[model samples]
Target: MEVNEMAAEECKAVLEHASLGRLGCSYENQPYVVPIHFAYDGGYLYVFSTSGQKVKWMRANPKVCVQTDEAQNQSEWISVIVNGQYEELPGPQYTAERKHASSLLAKRSHWWLSALGERQMRVGDKLIEPLFFRIRIHSMSGLRFTDEKERRG
Candidate 1:
């Protein structure tokens, strides 16, 4: 098996095609990671979430990492890691962008269910408002592994 580094365009393609990733954030030397559904647009990854531990941590420390991948087999796989800064889009100033995010996310069915469900389970209230946030991509790197059979035909 041989592994290769993916170029910038390839990395963008991977990110564009992927909707799910592990969002990692750290604060006070503790790191937290969770699965997130996102929409890649322009230079940001728009995400939806309820006010939770990850949000609080990210608010304190903007630096974050997101890892996404596609795998066919052990040797046929691609993984991308992105370094970015978190920016929460909330309130009047970000009305347009927030709406845009809503539209993009609406493309996927049940997009709002997970967060709202979690909120309901925790607070036992359905009044919990959803939050929209974006990650401004600073850099990305990807690795792909290919075996002899894949490399041949």
Candidate 2:
């Protein structure tokens, strides 16, 4: 999709409001998709995962795509798509990003402090037994389906 068509602010809003998303990549020319939790920073996606198949696959192929959606009610919905390259964030990088992400998460009224709070520590300590990847977005778009349908892609 053409980058000019997408409004950066609206796309960012959609990303921030949605926590769960689908990470898409390829393995042996076969496409793969996995559900995961993510944090959307200024223009990047932060995802945590244990070292295993997905992480290995991503390493072998850093290119990826992600989709996140949110619905305020039956009458309205918004979905955002991010196309990017994935890179494992090093210790220092993860620490800094984790602190910012955790702070934003903490600000949400529905956020479970105990669970998300513990994750913050694990992320800070790089002790989740999981690999942390920073998805550097190259292009982003959003689609809104409310009383009217609008798309930016």
lDDT of each: 0.87, 0.73
| 35 Cα displacement, candidate 2 (Å) | 1.1
Model 1 pairs in collision: none
Q: After superposition, how far is residue 10 of candidate 2 from its true place, in Å?
A: 0.4
Model 1 alpha-carbon drift over 4 Å, by segment:
109-123, 126-128, 149-153
Off by over 4 Å in 2: 1-6, 92-94, 98-128, 148-153
What is candidate 1's lDDT per residue for 32-146, written digit by digit as tens?
9999888888989999887778999999999999999999876699999999999999889999999998777767525455657766788886545668999999999999988
Maximum-TM-score candidate: 1
Q: Write the per-residue lDDT of candidate 2 for residues 39-146, one digit (tens) a residue.
A: 778778876565667787888998899998877655567778999998886687478776665565445422444554577676775444544577899998887765
- Give the Å error, residue 143, model 2: 0.7
On the 0 to 100 scale, the lDDT of residue 123 in model 2 is: 72
What value does the lDDT take at residue 72 in candidate 1? 88
